[model samples]
Every structure is written in structure tokens, then in C-alpha cells.
Target: MKTETIGTATFETWTVAETADAFARDEIVLIDVRTPQEYMFEHIEGALLMPLSFFKAGKLPGQSDKRIVFHCGSGVRSERVCRAAIEAGITQIAHMEGGFAAWKAAQQPYIGTNMATGAPQRAPA
Candidate 1:
């Protein structure tokens, strides 16, 4: 991961390809900071939910050593979340560049449907 300094805030960033590769290898954990509804609309498979609206300034779920890669609609919110995590003393933190938009643009495999329904449905055959 590469480092960049923006005044008092500094965090690492990963491109879509890098993120996908890391995810494929189980090298990093993806955290989606978008709203639950937005997440339900479409999101990367296996990502943990930590919506910014209900975010707490502390360690997230899972082990401390795992790398956490935060992402949102357009990378803005996730950056804020990452900074907050940093302030909260989380060292292994990163954010996806261009956020979920880039991932969608890249046509990466994701899970979700635009239609909102509570009924249980069969998985794709």
C-alpha cells in the first residue's frame, strides 16, 4: 500500500485492481461505510457493514491484525472513516480509490440487486 499525506490526515490507498487482488487472496477485509439501503442495492461480497451513520470510534469487528480497507459510494465517506479509524489508533487501515464506483466501473463481481424485497429467494443457478 502507498502512503499520502494531507495535512494532519494520512492514510493508505489501494486501486481497484489491487483491492480485488487482496480480497481474492484474503489479504484484507473490506468495510462498506454506505447506508444499509445503498449497501443492499449492491455491494462487494463478504464486505462487513459499518455504516458511517452508526460508526463508533474504536476497533471494528474481526482480529486486530487484519488489514481493513474502507470504501463508500465515491471514496469521500470512506476517507473520513479511515481518518477516524486512524485517530482511534487503528494502524492497519486503507481505503479503496474511487470507492465502489470504481469497482463497479471495472465490472468486478459484486452481490446485490436493485430491487428491495424481504422474501427469501434462491441463489443464482
Candidate 2:
């Protein structure tokens, strides 16, 4: 992981392969920083929506062991969220490289459309 300091906070970046592997192993919390509409259109399985517009630091899931991986349509929003998370005292944080687009380009499996909305879904409760 490469570290970056934005202001006084530090964050890391992870490649699509790395993030995917972590997800498959249940070793990370995937946060999608896109709007609910975008998320409903397509998103990685098990990813929780934490849209940048309404992201709340206190609401992030507490995970001491599993890594927190944030992602967006193309990574920009996720980077913003990562910085916020770091400032909020989240120590283990990372954003996916190229974001969801890269994940899809890699042919990774994701949930979307009717499959994703067949059952009502909301951000983490």
C-alpha cells in the first residue's frame, strides 16, 4: 500500500486485483462513494454505499481487522472519502485504483439492475 498525506491525514491506495482478493477473502469493508442511483445501476457485491454527499464519519462501520476500501465511479470521490475517513481517525483505509470502472473492466462479478434492486436495499444501518 502506498501512503499519501492530504493535509494532516494519511491514506493508502489499492489496485483492483488486491481489493477484489480482499473482498473474496472477507478481509475488507468495501465502501462505494457514489450516489444511490449510480450504486443501484452497478456496484460490487457486498459493497456498502457511503455517498460523499452524505457521508458521516461516525456512521462508518467499526472494523479493527478488516481493511476499509473506498471506491467511486472513477476513484475521485473515493479519494475524498478516504481523506475524510483518515481525519476521522480511521487508520486502515484505502481507495481502489481506477475504482469500479477498473473492477468491471477486469471482468469481476458485481450486482446491478434488477438483480441489485429486486429486494429493497439501503446503506448500512
Please give, for residues 1-125, the per-residue lDDT of candidate 1 as tens digits.
67976555468988999999989999888999999988877788889889999988575864465678899999999989988877886655689999988998898888756345654333231
Model 1, C-alpha of 6: deviation from truth (Å) = 7.7
Q: Which ten residues in a row have the lowest lDDT in candidate 1?
A: 116-125
| lDDT (Cα, tens digit) per residue for candidate 2, span 1-125 | 67887666558899999898889999998989999999887778799888899998878877777878899999899988887787888765789989988888888888756564476433221
lDDT (Cα, 0-100) at 114 in candidate 1: 34
Count the clashes in each prediction: 0, 0
Q: Give the TM-score of candidate 1.
A: 0.81
Model 2 clash pairs are none
What's the true lDDT of residue 31 in model 1?
91
lDDT for 88 in candidate 1 is 80
